[model samples]
Target chain A: MSSFPPFTRLAASLPDHVPFVGPEAIERERGTSFAARIGANESGFGPSPRVIEAMQASAGDMWKYCDPENYDLRSAIADQLGLDVEMVVVGEGVDGLLNLAVRMFAEPGEAVVTSLGAYPTFNFHVTGFGAKLVTVPYRDYREDLVALAEAANANNARIVYLANPDNPMGTWCEADAVEKFLAEINPHTLVILDEAYCELAPASAIPAIAPLRPNIIRMRSFSKAYGLAGIRCGYAFGPAELIRPFERVRTHYGVNRMAQVAALAAFADQAYLSEVVGLVAAGRERITQIAEENGLKALPSATNFVAVDCGADGVFAQKVLDNLIAQGIFVRKPVARGLDKFIRVSVGLDHELDLLAEALPKALATARI
Target chain B: MSSFPPFTRLAASLPDHVPFVGPEAIERERGTSFAARIGANESGFGPSPRVIEAMQASAGDMWKYCDPENYDLRSAIADQLGLDVEMVVVGEGVDGLLNLAVRMFAEPGEAVVTSLGAYPTFNFHVTGFGAKLVTVPYRDYREDLVALAEAANANNARIVYLANPDNPMGTWCEADAVEKFLAEINPHTLVILDEAYCELAPASAIPAIAPLRPNIIRMRSFSKAYGLAGIRCGYAFGPAELIRPFERVRTHYGVNRMAQVAALAAFADQAYLSEVVGLVAAGRERITQIAEENGLKALPSATNFVAVDCGADGVFAQKVLDNLIAQGIFVRKPVARGLDKFIRVSVGLDHELDLLAEALPKALATARI
Candidate 1:
């Protein structure tokens, strides 16, 4: 109602559409659970036994408020990354950090550059902050870094985002190309390299942490390789000067106490992480083989998920995705223009994949008709 | 360093001091944990057993990201508060929600009104957003509503914040005055009535939820009486139209899975909540007795904590606080110019209050110049 409290002008003009819907809601709507839980890029392996133990052990301490400074977790990440603790700031997740970064860099109406089909959450934050988005179409199913850099330079964009071993497309460029892209970034633009999947990707595909660029912030999450998404935790590393501004606006106590504890314990159990990564790799291969057998081409993936081209138009891909959903398989499709011809699937447990194997043939046959 | 981030002019000018220093940091520095953990106003009474059980049971779900919609929690809160689900928005905490509310309503350099020594976190968010803070001094130790509304009208302020059974001072106004203040509010202005301590206060002090004003948003937390502080959850309820804009800027998935489970369980266990409230009221009496015996004036409190007038200035209050800390007691003081004469303390367990009683006289003697 116009009689309602006045929202600031920027907030008044913002759209009401959310970026993505959760599978839980879909299940509630469909009145049935998906047999194959391979959507949303979450780890089927779950958190480490040590992490669960730590969380349970600390359950009684839920009476106390969390450390607002996030001191210990930042120190742990800083030590692991070969950087000072000041170079790090952790939040609810990469999603929360992305929102803060957008607000800090791009005020209202400034252009921000990213791939057309990169993480929709990043675009959501850009739009949430009233920033103008300038998209560079994916080239070869990978983020077109050269074009993105050019767009940033031409538009004098305030921020540029890229996700290596990216979502929906499941492709990555090697570290050398990433380094070169970093070098070519416009002086006025800050680059946010979201490496949420880096731990699961091939080592060579990740840029080395040593030569940390001042204008670049690389965000990581315990949600993927470490498997604690429900805890709502993630971290970003960058120049101290760049990172410090986040304190000005971030929800200081945004990260829950269990999250800080779970993430810390998850990080401590490197053995569990390695084991999960190995299992994910094997699952990805199994998925690729299944795709090949079905006469569809799964993209060469360096991350925990595979994006399979339906070998047709976006309409065909949507039909296939719908068939999969109808067949009780949970999977997601890319919605960005030109990137819409593929469906992305995360690596689930063995039995879950078995369900996928059992259901995909029928879903594909139905789509074909 | 400046080369790393060209922060927006507003961000660059923000002061670096954090809103609150955590007690754990104090414990770590002091090499001993505090006997009385009352400074943060946390419910030393702890959360309900059912809440703890629910959290433990849901610990394994850490791998799956929490439902971004917080569908179940929102519905439960809405049903309890007699509002539509769409009118209730969950956030990390009242602090987190305040940040969003201020941003959605207040513009840079515009005035936002609050009592002089109310919640520092609210002030933190206001200043963080570049709004000029207009303060009304407390009258006879209570938040002066008349002064606050007058200041709001004079400054043409877009937002005003009031905390019932207010923080730092542990005082409140009657429901009639609060209703009058809301009715008299300018249509262009939004009033944030923070009822975080409402559950522990007298029922007559809080207005009925059905009488919704378009410009009013009331915040509630499970932190105080429910004792789920470490879980970091709170909610804001307002008219549907006013509440919808929060979707534009909020960190949707910020509240963790455990928080949702715990909060639901806490809400369901009304018997446990009533028991905790009884204990808190008794503990407040105990704290008052100790203060009165020591010749300090303990203010009448509706909240879980008591604010004791230390019979001296802020520096002397700091001495009393420091001496208590040195003696392994954790307590805090309000730092506003007029309100600095009182030190705030939460009602801890009997043994903890016993420790406070034993230590106070020696600390008082030493605190004197």
Candidate 2:
């Protein structure tokens, strides 16, 4: 074998794998397109027309590099949130920001706390950084905030990650309860509240933006409700002191110029965002109805997706997911132990949801066999 | 004072600063736009029409996240270079890939070798990762390849970074010399060959893609000759084993979807690239003549930008740069000791170059005072 460069012990120790298999990969592997693209939790309603127009107008100006500071976008985000621009740092995506957070807050061998079945990308980063993961299992389909706080104090962890209106399960904890959890946690640990799906969530589930705390970094994204996931834009707001450290580690020009332009336009069109939220809510009801017809329980959700229980074990849920993929219906399921009995489906356009409604019965029937 | 979350030892020790102040920041501070946007080395000619068309067409499809694997773009790159798909990885930009490389290769307190004045972004990442930077001085305004190789071996450095068609000086070492340097280096040390401006350089300066080395990662970008700097897309290719590990640490969806489509279209249009090359060459000669007209010497460049010696000192060059900026002409200068006596100007649109020609003598006369 040819000799190779030596990777750091930490990097070499991590598994060489992608955290999630993107829908494009599955399509390439199957040699057929998914009839319903209700997978991956992306908005199928697309970005606002104004956002697309802005992107198209700036297409010829792609020769210039993006602003390294992300000043304009940061200012806009801060303006909307009633915070100083220094309190916000825009990144390529929330995933990118999370990667930086792990490096900034957690050293090698330090502990990071999270719920067991939360966003895998956060776990991937903690592992890549050689940080020890202390996971708390979900309590009754929601993140066990009290257990997570206890674990953080017990382990003296440097960072704790929580996603409100959580992924895969689409369950959420009330904002007031989350605030209580925050108060109960050790002040030395940084809390990363990934609010990517916040816009799709109910107003009560989102905390008021005021009184910024140094120990908390709240992340928001254009990906979920703004419908600009493909553009790769997200922002994190925290105390100015904490946000300043991001300069030391972030890829300065990682957020593309087109992303900045599109995000700014999307942020301006709150009307479009509200319309999409209503559409998503109606689509979730349709999915719930569809699950009822199949005699399965659809979990109550606050985000864009609904998780439908397969009424059996993890094995049965896996079979159902495989059968759905085989039938050219793209959907994902939570893999964590208690959560594996459910399949998660994002709200897509009407035709896409109709196709999912058509495919679920056949998929469930096949799994029963 | 409010208590803050505990940051890592490395993160705490680093200075919170931007490596380079972007022109947008300058514009914001000065309250005026640059009349001639020839600084930062972005192409004034812009990307091809087809690439723009592709970006505009995909603007509405921003709801889907990018492929984590970057499969199609990697396949096209591998096919063009006659390498296997596994040998390539696409990133947000060369800057993003450099961030990953530092984390993967250099552990805290380990050494990384580079020229005293190379890409500042690379230096930023090295410091951010808590790696010691071992610097070698430039020889004759070009990177001293022999000294760099020696430093890597002596320090037992994990990474040695060299930009072919070196930045700031716009000088290059021939392919044969680079190969010799590569052969003499420690096999265990990784060599990062940043070929960002390779397309503008002579073919003799670029080594053949065959005979892949396990220790070398060669990076290229659509940011330069392809005129897509704002899109944030670049790729690194090397042996498959080394490439695989990037997946472990990379932010999977960091590269945006429009970037993929625009870059693929950019890659397909080699004719536009050649035309840009011809334009850049003519522009370089014009800059050289302008330098001579102002009683200075313009260094021969293999890259798109020309570095003109001020025929005085670093102070004179700084004054000239300041004067240009005062007149709303954006230009940059090298900050390292020997290279600091020169001012660098990127080729701009014809009218912008004409503005440069009109502004030079006045700026020089004011600097002489």
List all candidate RMSDs to the true structure. Answer: 1.2, 1.1
Residue-wise C-alpha lDDT for candidate 2, range B102-127, written one tens digit per residue: 88898779999999988999999999
Displacement of the residue B27 alpha carbon in candidate 2, Å: 1.0
Give the docking tier of candidate 1.
Answer: medium
Error of 2 at A217 (Å): 0.6
Predicted model with the maximum lDDT? 2
For residue A300, what is the lDDT in candidate 2? 92
| Candidate 1 TM-score to native | 0.98
| DockQ of each candidate relative to the true complex | 0.73, 0.79
For each candidate, give its TM-score against the true structure: 0.98, 0.99
- Candidate 1 lDDT by residue in tens digits, A246-297: 8888887788788999999999999989999899999999988888888988
Q: Give, for candidate 1 chain B, the lowest lDDT window spanning 10 residues.
A: B1-10
Q: Write the per-residue lDDT of candidate 2 for residues A324-369, one digit (tens) a residue.
A: 9998889999999999999999998999888888888999999999
